[model samples]
Target: MKLSCTECGQGRSITDPVWRCECGGLLQVEQRLGELDGEKLRRVFDERLAHRNTPYASGVWRYKELIHPELPVERIVTKYEGNTGLYDSEPVRRFTGVRDLRLKAQSENPSGSFKDNGMTVAVSQGAWLGYERFACSSTGNTSSSLAMYAALSGKASYVFVPEEGVAGGKVLQTAAYGARMIRFKGTYDDGICFLERHAAELGLYVCNSMNPFRIEGQKSIVYEIAQALNWMLPDWIVLPGGALSNGSALGKGLQDMLATGLISRMPRVAVVQAEGASPFHRMIERGLKELTPEPRPHTLASALNIGNPPSWKKAAAVLQATCGVTVSVTDEEIMEAKAVIDRAGIGCEPASAASAAGLRKLVARGIVDKDETAVCLLTGHMLKDTDALQRYVTREAADAGMPVSSALELEQVKERM
Candidate 1:
């Protein structure tokens, strides 16, 4: 695999420590191979999955032919990332008013978010590149994943969090992984800027999604979803858009899949964004070519509170490729979706439920037909942002139709009863 700039066509070996080209364009993983044999590849991946003893059993590495195909097995570092659960919940189906709904929960991953899908490969690449130190700026999930992967690889890790920061749960997850925590006095964009400015001087390998390998790894999510459904393409793929890396990765994966003849149809990808932090959605709504960051991005789902997503260029490319559109939902919508998901016993973080909220919005708007097969990618676990859940369940910020009290149980027996 080689890294190629999206804009300037600059090329370098994948092992190079370059996230962007000299022309300041983002990089993507480019393959130097003949036509991919999708059928043979699928058989090979199936063989690996059947063998419980092999490293190829990892959902990401199982499709390594499409994901850093040349990386040696021994050189890879994995905490068995990926292999997250994909469920079809009747309650969620009814709540979203979508037929044939599938929820791809990345929360089941080792690091508790879709970031682990990328983190495994990116950190492995960092190790293979002989980097001894690594760093990233996160709203929460990215930092937590980076810290865990860095620790597993025996590399020093640094994480820059937003000044307003994120839920203590995620911050504690990062700290528990032993990464040196640095707080910048601004939003996540500012934290990213700070990391980029100091990363070279500090000799730290940047492991954010801007890293092409990181984006490449996340494609496994799409791959897994396709595989779970016996390689059939759903009518729609919905996901929360924060940094927008996951959407871009899914789009690229579909392109590759089509090239390899894995699926016969392309799914319309819908990137769900929080209304408070919906610059990408606004750009789409206005039919504008240029993207502008929101001056004051605000959302209780801290993970999606990014004003300036570095992956915007790649993400926009994804939308163009899949004929995808953006859907922004309010925090109220997200929390209500979360409540339904929680009640269904398929829990997700607040931002993760944006996919459900957007699905509901799209269904109501007639954008998504009720009978269409759709997959909603849930990005993180409920515990990743416990503070948000606390507020909801503790009745501090109940939604319009939320249940005020739970059913009476023996644990809380009343003398009057």
Candidate 2:
């Protein structure tokens, strides 16, 4: 594997301590999978399911050859992340108007978010490079996941987050994991800018999605989804867009699978962005060649509040490659979808519900066929943002001047029920 510049095509060894190319472009990991026997590889992956060990037991590491093939097994750091369940929910199917819909609950990971999938690979890569300190800027999930992995691996971790707007549950998780937290009076984009500007000066290895190794780990999400479907590609893979790293990684993984003959076709990717923070969707709608960042994005979905996503270029490429589409949903739509998912007992954070919301819009517009099979990727668990859920459940009561609760006798409760 080699690191290649997405723009200038400059190449460097994967071990190079660099996140971007000299030409100001993001770096991507390019792996050469020579003459893969698709059927044989599939059997090998399935057989590893019985192995109750370190790397193979991990859903990400189980597909090591497709991920970081050059990275040694001894260098791996894993909490056996991944292996999240794919569920067929009747309510979700009915809401999205799809005949067969699957929810890939990435929230089931050890860290209660999909971030664990990427954090494992990134922390392991840092260890392999002899780095003992790591850092990142997060709205919530990334910080918690990075902190948990770094703490478990005996590495010092520092996290930068906006002074406000982050969920209490996520912040508490980061603190409990022992990461040194830094808060600044600005937006998530501001925190990211600070890390990019000062990572080298602080002697910190950044574990954000900008790290190619992180993307490599995230590719395993796509692999697991395909494996769950028995190697059959779905018609559409819908996911909420935040930093855009997950979508980019999914696209790259699909390309890898196609190259290896593991699958016959590429699944069309649909990226759902919050309406308030929809630079990617705007770019798609305006037929623009580049994204124009939102200056002050605001959304109830804290995770999707990012205005300027760093991985927009990579995500755009993925959409182009797969003939995919991008769409944005209002905060209200996001909350409505979240309520449905939660009511169905398949809870997800507000941002994760954006996939369901956008899929519904797509189906209504005939962009996604009602009869097609689609898998909606839930990025984080519902408990990651209890504040949002509380607000959602209380909004109507607050608006109506009704008490959220009332004192009642046992007989009254039984009568109401």
Candidate 3:
């Protein structure tokens, strides 16, 4: 496999540990396609899925041919990262006014977030390269995933996050997994700069989406969605955009599927971001080539509180190819959507609820047809940031029209006391 720069088109072999191009552009895993033996792939994938007891059955590794297939099985580090369920969420559908909206509950992954899908492959590649240490800068989910996978692969792990920025659940998970945790007194983008300065000198493998392999691993989400639908493509795929890595991967994955005849049509992709951290949405709406990132993005959904997303260029290009658009949502809307999703018994993090909130916005704007089949990607579990949830259902978000039953429960408890 070869890594190609999105800007200058410079190519390098996968053996190179470099994450970016000489021109400081993001590198993409340049993909090539050949005639796929559809029957054989389908049979083998179905057979492996039927077994479900081995690593080969993992939703990610089962599509290895589409990913990096050259690695030996022993070099693969997996906890069956994919294999999430497609939850038919009636509450979300009613709230968003989308008749066939299904929530793809990625929280079922081993790490309670979608980051595990990419981390498994990234750590596996590091193992193949005989790397002893891996590193990443994250808000929360990525650190937790990297820590867990690095531990399983017997590799040292280092994580950098904003001081007092990340959720305790993720920080605790990383520390419990024996990773060296470093807290920087800055934002995630600042942490990225910090890691870049130290990664090469320290001989650490930086495993952010800036590394194309992480995007490659995320492509499995597309494959799993198609497989779950029996190779039928949805009309739209709505997901929350933080660094825009998943959006970039979804567009490229769709192109690959189209080339391989796995799906006959294209799905319009929609990436939703919190209003405070919506550089991509701003650029798209303003028709600009680039954006000045938010100086200090603030949102209750901590995961989406990114100022400068590394994958912005790649994400823009892919969204253009697929006729996609970016949408922004407010914290109030996100919590209200979260409450509805929770009422449906399909819980997700506040950031993950952006899809539902944005869907409502898009539908109101007539950008998304309420009748079209749509699938929303829920990227993290509700427990990923429970403090925000509690604040909403208990105190600060009371005027935001949160579920009445939760407030009623508090009243009942007070009366009982």
Candidate 4:
């Protein structure tokens, strides 16, 4: 595989210690898959479902040839990440008005978030490069996943997060995994800017989605979804847009599958950003060629509060390639969707609920057909951000005027019931 600049079309060796091209464009991995047999590969992937081995056991590594064909098995650092569940929830289907809606619960991964899928590949690639330290700037999930994987791989980890707005559970999880936490009184975009400026000087291997290796690993999410559907393509793939890395990765993976004859059609990607932090959405709505960053992005979905996403260019390309749509939803809409998912016993973090809310909007607007098959990706587990849940419940209770009342006697309780 070779690293290719998204803008300048410059090619560089994969061993280069650079995240971006000299022109400051993001780098993407260009893999060389020699004459892949779709049917044979499908059978092999199906058989590996029961392999119980090192690489195949991991959902990301199960499709190693497509992910990182050059990486050796002995150098892999995996926690058997991926293998997350896909559920058909009646409430979610009804809420979105999509009859064939499948919720891809990525929260079931090792780190309670989809970040583990990318972290395994990124950390393994860093280890292969003989790096002893790894680092990333995150809102929550990325830091937690990085810390966990770094601890497992015996590498030092450094996490930079905004001083405020991050969920308590994510901070606790990162600390528990023994990462050196660094907080700044700014946004996640600020933290990422700082890291981009000083990561090389500090000799840190950045494992954020900006790292092409991370995107390579995350592509497995698409692979797993397709494999679960017996190699059939979905009509739409809905996901929350934060850094835009997941959507970009999904688009790339789908293209790869199509080129290799694993699938025949492309799924229209629908990326949902928080209304307060919807630069990409605005760009699409205004018919702009470039994104204008939100100066002070605010959202109840902490993970989607990034103002300037680094992967916007890649995401834009994906949207263009797949006839994708971008939309923004209010915090109220996000919370309402969260409640629906929670009531259905398929809980997700606030950010993850954005997909459902966005899908609902798309369906209402006639952008997405209710009869078409769609897979909504829930990025993180509900427990990842208990603070958001607490606030949501408290506000809901206040708005509804006390959902419960004290009952001193059994008669009173019975009467209330």
Candidate 5:
């Protein structure tokens, strides 16, 4: 249960709340791989379920042993955020030219975003570490999710979001959870900088990408994917990247499962980002092996509008280990991909759609074969930013607006057109 700095080799106890090493590198979990008896771990985890079996119901708890220690489990409020559906995607398969396609629909989680997976674990760890207050800088989803979980964990939550980010439904959701919502005039980048410089004095736990527990929770998604596929690894895992912690966690989780003999092969990880805010993509274009986060990233996919992601080094390690590739899609293409996914019965945020857009790009470039098995990680629900989505959808539906209530009437209008 000890953690280590990947860059400096400085070891620390897992209970410490330190965010980074003296070398200014992200701290990574460094667990001993003793001949891990997977069955034994499962048995112990199952026994602990008697207290509140619901934690084991989904997400991190389902793969509890991978990240959690053998110590007493802390109680925190989570919406049982993980273990989202591994939905079969025929449309995605056809579109991406990947014959076997599945979607890890994290958007179905309580807060309509994959950040819940991180928030739940971070909140649990905070409660365990005697922290009573939580805070983060988010575009939208993470702030709202952390606030909701903090409320359940008897912790005060503070969220700092950009003034523009507050335009979506996210601001209301965060406020509704009774979190201290601070709006910044700038983007998420400014908020992150402000939080980092001020967090210690404010006595607030910076629960953004720096917190190890969030990535630990995110690792559960890979475990769930393996379990859903009967422990078979996919050829690729596609997901949108902002802070890149989730992508990093996927690589680590897969490695953990491989070590434990839970799966046989490792998957190639693919990160998708909007073209307007693609620092990772720019790094690739420059023949750089890692992403050096910019200072003012902006995009229609607000969740991915991060300038300087704290976990950039860890993310580089992840891509290196997984032989991953990063792709960038234009905002227009992401919007089109969103419409396509929605037509396929999977409504998603722009960031989530970026994953599918990446797949399409891969197919166009003749990189991914039509028969390859791929999994698109849909990170957020479309409803998370309802106001923007409403404008988008309503503007498209303007032609059919005259007192059309029934489905038949809508169809009739379409037929007329």
Candidate 6:
């Protein structure tokens, strides 16, 4: 399939290295109206030459023809980033008041976040295009994911991180992946703004959600959801929102599935943003046709601390099409939800907890019904914020006075059982 400008309708392909419209708008996949036959798609997957080396037996590769039909079956990069598992948790149901609640455990991905879904595809596509280096601006999750995948593919990587964001596990993970780091003394949004203006000059590909390939990769999440649920569309999907790119891509993915007849209906989308940065939430509350922000958006969920989302135009369309509501969660609520998620044995960062918290709030307000099947997207691993996690645990331990020792130290000695 050829990629066309979302704004101006210009087209590009793997042969074209310059992935943009002449008018400067980013490109989107040019899809035609149709439906995918599951049996046929499955057969294609079963016969894939690259299936042996891939991570997930079913990922975008399941719909390989849609992504890169022209490329050889063996040439596509397949790290099995997609096909993450979905778990039905009683704790999640008890907290959200939705009887049929499912958790999309994206933190289980190789890079410990949902960003791997996009990064894998971007890396594969870049490799197919014969690029030896890749670059992206990230809050943390994306750069780490890209670094790991790029290394796996023998590609050099460059990542930009905000100075304030350099204190967490994400920063360590990026360095661990061997990516050359560039620290920007600004917010994640500002770093992205800088990249958008200078990346082309630097000859580096932007692997952020601003890139269309990111959405192509992210569509696998929806693919897995439909496949796992036997093609049943949930009543609603609750997800954390920073840039709103994931939600926007999710909506577009479902729309692609619908067009291909993979699913009969689309789920209503609910956007969950941190209260500290609730511009999107505010805009949705006022029913604003346009999603323009005032200024200075900040949030504890560092991954979503973007004030000027590059994908806002597409995000606005997603909210409108799904009639989705945006809910803002406070730092306190996010922390509380982190405890809830930890207790449930699925530890995630505050951003991931935001979705769980938002859904709980919706149920409490009676905005979402108990009968509706809901899915909360857990976007990142709690370990990514070990400092914050350490603080949280230390405070709890101090209040309770529970004995604390290093795991290794405890393992070296025996306790009286």
lDDT of 5 by residue, 141-252 (tens): 8898898888887789999888774446888888999999887788787877787678878888878877888888888888778866767878999989887878888888
Clashing residue pairs, backbone N/CA/C < 3 A, model 3:
none
Q: How much is 314 displaced in model 2, in angstroms?
A: 0.3
Cα deviation at 216, candidate 4, in Å, is: 0.3
Summarize candidate 4's per-residue lDDT along 8-107 as a digit string, tens digits.
9999998886889989999999976547778888888888899686778999999998999889999899889999999999988999998899999999
lDDT of each candidate versus the true structure: 0.89, 0.92, 0.87, 0.92, 0.79, 0.79
Tens-digit lDDT track of model 2 for 1-417: 899999999999989878899899999998776567788889989998887976899999999888887888988899999999999999989999999999999989998999998999999989889899999999999999999999988999999988777888999999999999998898888988898899999889999888998999999999999998998978999999999999999999899899998999999999999999999999999999989989888888999989899999999999999999999999999998998999899899999999999999999999999999999999999999989988877885687666556668896566546
lDDT of 4 at 293: 90
What's each prediction's TM-score? 0.95, 0.97, 0.94, 0.97, 0.91, 0.91
Considering TM-score, which of the candidate structures 1 and 6 is the better prediction for this target? 1
Misplaced by over 4 Å in model 5 are 39-53, 74-76, 165-167, 289-292, 398-417
lDDT of 3 by residue, 218-279 (tens): 99899899988998978999999998889988887888778777778899999999998999
Better of 2 and 5 by TM-score: 2
Task: Say what the RMSD of model 3 is.
Answer: 3.1
For residues 369-414, write the lDDT of model 6, one tens digit per residue: 9988998999998887776678778988888755665455554455
Looking at model 5, residue 237 earns an lDDT score of 92
Mark the regions of model 4 whose C-alpha exceeds 4 Å error after superposition: 398-409, 412-417
Which scores greater on lDDT, model 5 or model 6? 5
lDDT (Cα) of model 6: 0.79
Off by over 4 Å in 1: 396-417
Worst window of 10 by summed lDDT in candidate 6: 408-417
Worst 10 residues of 4 by lDDT: 399-408
lDDT of 1 by residue, 1-417 (tens): 688999899889887888888898899999843578888988887777785656687878888889987788898888888888899899999999987999999999998999999988999999988899999988889999999999998899999887783888999999999999988778888877776778888999998889999988999999999988999979999999999999989999998888888888899999999999999999988998888998679999989999988998899989888889899999999999999898899899999999999999999999999999899999999999999988888784254434556568775445223
